[model samples]
Target: MSALELVLLLVLVTDPFGNLPLVLAALGRLDAAAYRRAVVRESLFAFGVLLVLGWGGAGLLQAFGITQPALYIGGGVILFLLSLRMIYGNAQGAFDDGYAADPLLVPIAVPAIAGPAAIATVILLRTQQAVPLSQLVLGLLCALLITLATFLPGRRIAAWLGPRGVNAMEKLTGLLLNLIAVNMMLEGVRRFLG
Candidate 1:
């Protein structure tokens, strides 16, 4: 794929919309001011993580003797399980408690936004081709910016969507995630066999 297409796919895999339920659920207990601060902080945190991984992830994996297929399969399994939780309406246990002073870097930023799929995508993109490091970073930045945009107006969105609407959206997102997860797994298997 072209660089722009890769960036777009990364944004989709980042799955900010899919993660809205989790982000909104975590933010539900916060006041408006706190919510806005948390969103910005978490977005930056996720971006930093992605940037680091984009630059150093291949080296780190090599140091640990991990293969690309392993990364793909492992990430796919984690995403599949998370998506299942969303589909079954049992996602609460998967999230941090609402009482967290700030769930900035944990559920919201880590696995929710800069998730396994996203991390693996960055690493794969960086290592699999002659693509410039700058371009990979650019893609990561674009994806994170889109995530920030989605999250900044979250309160208004939650209010407009209400509980049921959020749930429906979450289910749809979960379904999409499942498809991505399966594709990842299949690709991993193909690479491993080849």
Candidate 2:
């Protein structure tokens, strides 16, 4: 894939726009300055996690004797399920229950930013696409920068978009994800048959 395609895939899996409400809920109790700090901190933490996974995930897969086709099919299935949830599920209340008073990184960074789908995509890019480490790092950086930009002004954007608008956008993102997932699966099947 081209660098732009890699970045776009990373951004789609990151799903920053869809996770705006969750981020706001996680940091809602903090002051403005604290909120900004948390956003930056959590984003960094997420980047670190994704970087580690992207670099080391291939080794782990090899250790388990997993093949490229298997990884592609599994990743596609996971993304497909996530897209269905994004399209039809009630994501607004994702973090409504069992959240810390002063959240650190559990809800926002891990699942919201560097979730399973994102992690899987990073690994797929590294292994399936054989993206160079430098290019992968650059693509990840670009994607996370876009996510961070979205998060910094999350509240204002949320207000401007309104709940309904946000929901609409999430569904649209979901539709895109579904197409990507199907393509991934098709590639996997082709590889397996070949």
Candidate 3:
């Protein structure tokens, strides 16, 4: 894949737009300054987690003797399921509002930004795609930056887009993700057969 494609894929998996509602809900109680601080902090934390996973994922897979084909298939399945959820389910309703007034890093950082789908995508990009580590890291950084940019003004963006607009955008992203997932699966099947 080209560098742009890699970055786009990373952005899609990170899915800042799709996760906006969750982030807003999680950080709703905080004041303006606290909200900005939490968003930046949690985003940084997520970046660190994903960076580690991207660097070590291949070694971890090799340790387990997991093949590329398996990773491709498994990752594709996971992405497909996540896309389905994005398309059909209520993103906000999926999680509970049980967070404290000043949330730290549970929902917003881990699962919201660097969730399983995002983690899987990073691993796949590191292992399955032939992109160099440097390029992958750069792409990851760019994607995260884009995510952070979206999140910084999330409330206003959400307001402008409104509920229906946000939902439509999420569904559109989900549709694109579904295509990518299928292609990944196909590539895996071809590699296995060959």
Candidate 4:
């Protein structure tokens, strides 16, 4: 896939727009400055995690005896399941809300921002495509940057989009993700059969 496609997919899976309410709730008690700082810090931390997985996840998979086909199929299945949640509007409750008051990283950085779906998708792209490491890194950075931008002004965006609008976008993105998941699975099956 092209760098643009990778970045777009990454952005969709990251789903910052959809997670606006969650972030707001987690950091709601904080002052404006603290909120901004938390947003930047947590996003950067999440980016660090994704970068690590994108860079070394293949070796980790190999160490675990996972083949490329298995990675593709697994990632595709996970993404597909996530998309189903999105499409059915059940994704709003899909993540844990057990974040502590004025949370820093646990829910925001780990599961919300760099969740399993995002991590799996990045690892899958890095392994499945012959895209250069530099390009993959660039794509991830670009996507994360967009996610950060959305998060910084998350409240305003959420106000503009509202809950219903965000849900609509989530469903649309979910449909696109479902299509990508099917393609990934089909490609994996073809490669495995060969």
Candidate 5:
């Protein structure tokens, strides 16, 4: 796929809107400066992780003989579940004690931001082959940057949306994720059949 496609796909799978609630909860206790710092740190850290994975991911997966469809389905399932669980309150244990107090880096950093889905998408981007490595890096970085910018202002955005608006957007994004899950399953079936 093209660099633009890769970036957009990453953005969709990452789903900053899904993160708004998390941001609001985590930052509820922090002061303004700390909130901003945490936002920048978590997003940048997540970006760095994805950048490394995007650069070397294809070779690692190829070495393991993992097929593209396998990655897609597996990653999508994990992501879909993550979204589903969060939406349905089935993912309450994503953090341990003290997490609620300082979750800016732990749960938010590792999974909420970088996330399994984004990591898998980076690997899939590697298999595209037509795209140059530099372009791939650029795409991933661009998407991550977008995530950083988007997520930083999430609290404000959430406020503007109000509870009703936020819930509406959350459900809409959830529906989108459900579609992504079905697409991933279909891709896996197609590849297996082929």
Candidate 6:
């Protein structure tokens, strides 16, 4: 993939829209102000997690004797499962109900934003690429900004999208994720057989 393609794929994999449910779920209980805060926090935290992965994850994996094929196999599985959740799981609105009484750090910041799929992607991608610390920081920030922009205004965004738009977006994202999953799985299989 070209550099731009890689970046776009990264964005697709990161999937700010896909993250909406988890974000809303985690902050759904809070008032608007608190909800906004939680959104910002989750996005920033996600950025931090990605930045660390981009900068140091590959080296750490290598130190532990991890191989590219292994990463492809493992990471692909994680990504597949995560993307399946995005595709076949609950209605998008379901996530907004649980956050009022719970902590935003758990359901929101974790698997929602910085989940295993993300960590594995970072680790796997970091193998073929080594982002400069500064570039990694910038990339993470850009993703966070996107997440923040989408999430903080979810109600309005949801309204703007209406049912039609949301459904279309979800389907498109799912399609893209399926393609990504297939590619990852193929990469793994190829390396395993090579």
Please list the C-alpha lDDT of all candidates, in the order they appear. Answer: 0.77, 0.87, 0.86, 0.81, 0.72, 0.69
Regions of candidate 4 where Cα sits further than 4 Å from its true position: none
TM-score of each: 0.84, 0.95, 0.95, 0.92, 0.83, 0.84
* Segments in model 2 whose C-alpha atoms lie over 4 Å from true places: 94-96
Residues 118-167 of candidate 1: C-alpha lDDT, one tens digit per residue: 78777877776445788887888888778878788866776898878777
* Top-lDDT structure, candidate number: 2
What tens-digit string does per-residue lDDT give for candidate 4 at 1-194? Answer: 77778888888878776677678878878888888999999889988898899899889998999988887888788878877877886554765667676776778888877887899887887787766778878987897789878888887877898878877877887888888888878877887999
Better of 2 and 5 by TM-score: 2
Better of 5 and 6 by lDDT: 5
User: Residue 117 of model 6: what lDDT?
Assistant: 70
Worst 10 residues of 3 by lDDT: 94-103
What is the C-alpha lDDT profile of model 3 across 1-194, one tens digit per residue?
A: 89899899999988888888888888888888998998999989887888899999889898999898888888889889888989998677766768886677878788877888888888888887767889988998998789889999999999999999888988988889899899888888999999
Model 2 lDDT tens row, 76-106: 9988988998899856565566787467778
Error of 1 at 149 (Å): 1.8
Ranking by lDDT: 2, 3, 4, 1, 5, 6
Q: Report the Cα lDDT for candidate 1.
A: 0.77
Report the candidate with higher TM-score, 5 versus 6.
Answer: 6
Candidates 1 and 5 compared by TM-score, better number: 1
Clashing pairs in 2: none
